[model samples]
Target: MSTQFLDMRISSDSVQDTPQRELTSSSLFPYTFGDIGLQTASVSPSNVNSVRVTLNAYVRLLMAPSSNPTIIPNATFTVRRNGTTIFTTVYQKPANQLDITYEMAAITVVDFPPENEVLLGQIQYTISVSTNYGIGLGARSFSGIAVAGGI
Candidate 1:
């Protein structure tokens, strides 16, 4: 994608730091409830290339201690722009450790709105996480931040 990311910001101290959010296993689907966050800024649609979009997030997921820590958890992260899906990925949380942290990063590209109009308004950035298995219905935490800047 030719779209660029501008003004990246991390929710944690820095892009290198991984933030963790707790995840409780779901009885309904084995996956924990979605942990969602949002970041926004205004932009000038006329300057699509120059238009700044905040992105580049680093996520760290910590699995709760359990008797069976080897089950492994399936994790999914999604990023959306203007209510449109721009990026998505799935991975398995690492297993076996006193305190295990699974880290992942995402870099997003700006998608021009339909009809290429000069949009002078607020823009939306979204981050969400979904996980299943790990520790078998056990509680865990996933931490991450949006690293803002232009690609």
Candidate 2:
């Protein structure tokens, strides 16, 4: 049995097991805070496969807690294969998505590929983040996933 990411669902259905090994800060693409900022969290086949791509954009608004805040995080997700972008999702800040006075609702996962019924059971997917206007993922960028055939 091959590994998959039990968390990344293609719809209200699939999950993956190859989580921990799939994505990592070093394996991802290092896009600046303005360009196509993205990083490869994890991918199937332990390499770039043409099967499929799934991405989740995680954002944490870091306000200095002072009267003046300058650094704003750009929350978004995208994927690329061999240097070509196959998917991209932009998460905009809510109307008051900046005010650090109160706690607000966080953004959710933005799925793509139209969610077709006849999907590819086994596909190689990669992840990346938008850094054009926000800070990138640092130390806490590690996750877990079980591989197929018991490793």
Candidate 2 similarity to native, TM-score: 0.32
Candidate 1 scores a C-alpha RMSD against the true structure in Å of 7.4
Ten residues in sequence with the least summed lDDT for candidate 1 = 135-144
The positional error of residue 18 in candidate 1, measured at the CA in angstroms, is 11
Give candidate 2 misplaced runs (Cα > 4 Å).
Answer: 1-73, 101-126, 136-151
Please list the residue runs of candidate 1 whose C-alpha ends up more than 4 Å from where it truly belongs after superposition: 1-20, 27-54, 64-72, 94-120, 134-151
Please list the C-alpha lDDT of all candidates, in the order they appear.
0.44, 0.33
All candidates: CA RMSD (Å): 7.4, 12.3
Against the hidden reference, what TM-scores do the models get? 0.48, 0.32
Tens digits of per-residue lDDT for model 2 on 28-106?
5544211222222343444233222234333333321222245343344655433445666654443345553221212
Ten consecutive residues with minimal summed lDDT in candidate 2? 11-20
